[model samples]
Target: MATNGVHIIVSGRVQGVGFRWMTKMVAAKLHITGTVANQMDGSVEIYAVGASDQLAQFEAAVKASPTPSGRVSDYQATPLDPVPTFKNFDVIG
Candidate 1:
């Protein structure tokens, strides 16, 4: 079965540690597509696309990981129309 793509923007203590790397690892493990990057507001934004179950798995992982020293709070998600172009999940600059 195919799942819809989900785009999320998380805000919190989300930069300058290992969060982005961790995100890449998690996404790779779950076979997701998109990128994770640090925003100017001191929060990390994760844009992901994949099956609903897989995206949910990444969500669960995000909720489970021990946030880095800079992390504070996570925002909500904004689901987007599926873009079937991301070949693999990555950490963007």
Candidate 2:
């Protein structure tokens, strides 16, 4: 299967709001393999890899912020060459 990747940077009340955990859950549900972390600049960064359709769903879910407490003001997803490294989604500090 052809795989794709995306580097996402989410801003606005993302950190300390369980955003990373929420992302992990969503990614796992979407079968996306990657990592989500809190950036030094008070934003959340995610690297996700999966099929194009799955990645699209993951992006939408991340933007929606499944957790009510988390608020995603803005986000940017950049396409990347898929690297077969991640075996599962994780929340990283």
Candidate 3:
């Protein structure tokens, strides 16, 4: 299958709660390559590359809050044009 990419923004009680760590783990399991980072505005930003189905699954998984204490109030995913190259899923600062 061809690969696709998405840019996601997760809001609400996400930062400082292991959200990025859990996102990386989930992305790895789905064989997705991307980056998860905390935005200065209290949201979590994600850039993921994978199959379309996997990206949908990833969005669901992240919105459900895999981290013990994280709460995701909003999840928005936008299709990326010219998917960025990523070697692996990473938690970035």
Candidate 4:
């Protein structure tokens, strides 16, 4: 399996909405390893590393479902040239 990575920034109504936790759940389900955190600017930032297809699926899911309380108005995902290493997915403050 070829490993890949992405850096995602989700904006709009994402804070205090379990977005990070939900992201962690999705990442775990996809066998992705990385971290999700609430940025100081009120956006959600995620760094995920996994298979290319899985990453695509993950991105799709995130955009498609912004959780019950969260409303994702916009998002940007950038492919990482050199993927980072992570043991598991986590939610960080």
Top lDDT prediction, candidate number: 3
Instruction: Give the TM-score (vs. native) of candidate 1.
Output: 0.83
lDDT of 3 by residue, 1-93 (tens): 989999999999899888999999999889999899998999999999999898888888998997989999998989899988899998888
TM per candidate: 0.83, 0.91, 0.94, 0.94
**Local error of candidate 2 at 19, Å?**
0.8
lDDT of 4 by residue, 4-34 (tens): 9999998988888778888888888899899
Give model 2's TM-score versus the native structure: 0.91
Q: How close to the true structure is residue 26 of candidate 4, measured as C-alpha lDDT?
A: 88
Model 1 clash pairs are 12-72, 12-73, 13-70, 13-71, 13-72
Task: Give the candidates in order of lDDT, highest first.
Answer: 3, 4, 2, 1
Q: Tally clashing residue pairs in candidate 1.
A: 5
Off by over 4 Å in 1: 66-72
Clashes of each: 5, 0, 0, 0
**Which sections of candidate 3 miss by over 4 Å?**
none
- Candidate 4 Cα deviation (angstroms), residue 87: 0.3
Q: What tens-digit string does per-residue lDDT give for candidate 2 at 16-73?
A: 7778888888887889998998989998899999988998899988888857798889
